[model samples]
Target: MGGRGAEICCASIPRVWYPGMMVLVRWDMPDGLKHIVKEKMVEVEKYDETGSIYIHFFPNDEVRVVVSIYPGYSTAHPIRHYGKPENINP
Candidate 1:
């Protein structure tokens, strides 16, 4: 695409992927998101059909993240402090 931001398409997104499917637990994007999130388990706390999406981002993926997201959003939301290194912490 000319004059457009680079898009990193997931050539191999998990087979569980769908148009509006919710992740029940943490999921790792080692290949698709290696740059930003190395090989970490990105937690997707909860999800709704047309409402808020609860996401938890912790250093260990088992704790609660400090930041909170607004409910009932209809757009992509960015999460801070996400990702990790393959051999070390990010």
Candidate 2:
């Protein structure tokens, strides 16, 4: 792995479902941006047997969700805002 990157490996992800599911994505950037995003799940129209889910990171500590309904294909979905560490209230 080289250059700036962000990753949420399988070790960091859990198999069980929890309320308010959130994951900390490891982001390695020169500017040192925070990486955390809420877990989202949605259904998409499956045109074929191949499909995938994607998580997109942003500079402002935000994330966008995308899904592929079929292989070798891509589509755009509405962006969603997740809570940061500071966004939480006591």
Candidate 3:
């Protein structure tokens, strides 16, 4: 999913994470979070850091999600775990 200036760096990952590349979208949130973004465009990238969902782009054009959290907080869904791939699921 590159436009111009960037290129996909991730090559591949376990197929079990996502046996089939799926485009998952949930339209409703209790109160729609205006902060959740597709790309890393956070305002306070350091302290007031927010949560993020990273989809690794494989060479075959497939992907898996990777969530990262900083010290602060975010409006996105509260996840159970992060930095541990064994617990994450598609």
Quality of model 1 by C-alpha lDDT: 0.31
User: Candidate 1 vs candidate 3: which has greater lDDT?
Assistant: 3
Off by over 4 Å in 2: 1-19, 31-51, 65-73, 76-90
- TM-score, candidate 3, is 0.24
- Per-residue CA lDDT of model 2 for 49-74, tens digit only, reads 23344455655454533333322111
How does residue 12 of candidate 3 score in lDDT? 40
The digit string of per-residue lDDT tens for model 1 on 1-90 reads: 011222223322233323433333334434664633333333333222232333443444553211123421212333333343111112
Across residues 6-74, which tens digit of lDDT does each residue of candidate 3 receive? 233444433233323333422211346554333222221121223344443333333345434521123
Instruction: Give the number of the best model, judged by TM-score.
Output: 2
Query: Each candidate: RMSD to true structure?
Result: 12.7, 11.6, 16.2
Q: Candidate 2 has which clashing residue pairs, if any?
A: none
Ranking, lDDT, top scorer first? 2, 3, 1
Instruction: List the candidates ranked by TM-score, beginning with the highest.
Output: 2, 3, 1
State how far residue 34 of model 3 sits from its true place (Å).
31
Steric collisions counted per model = 0, 0, 0
Give the lDDT of residue 65 in candidate 1: 18
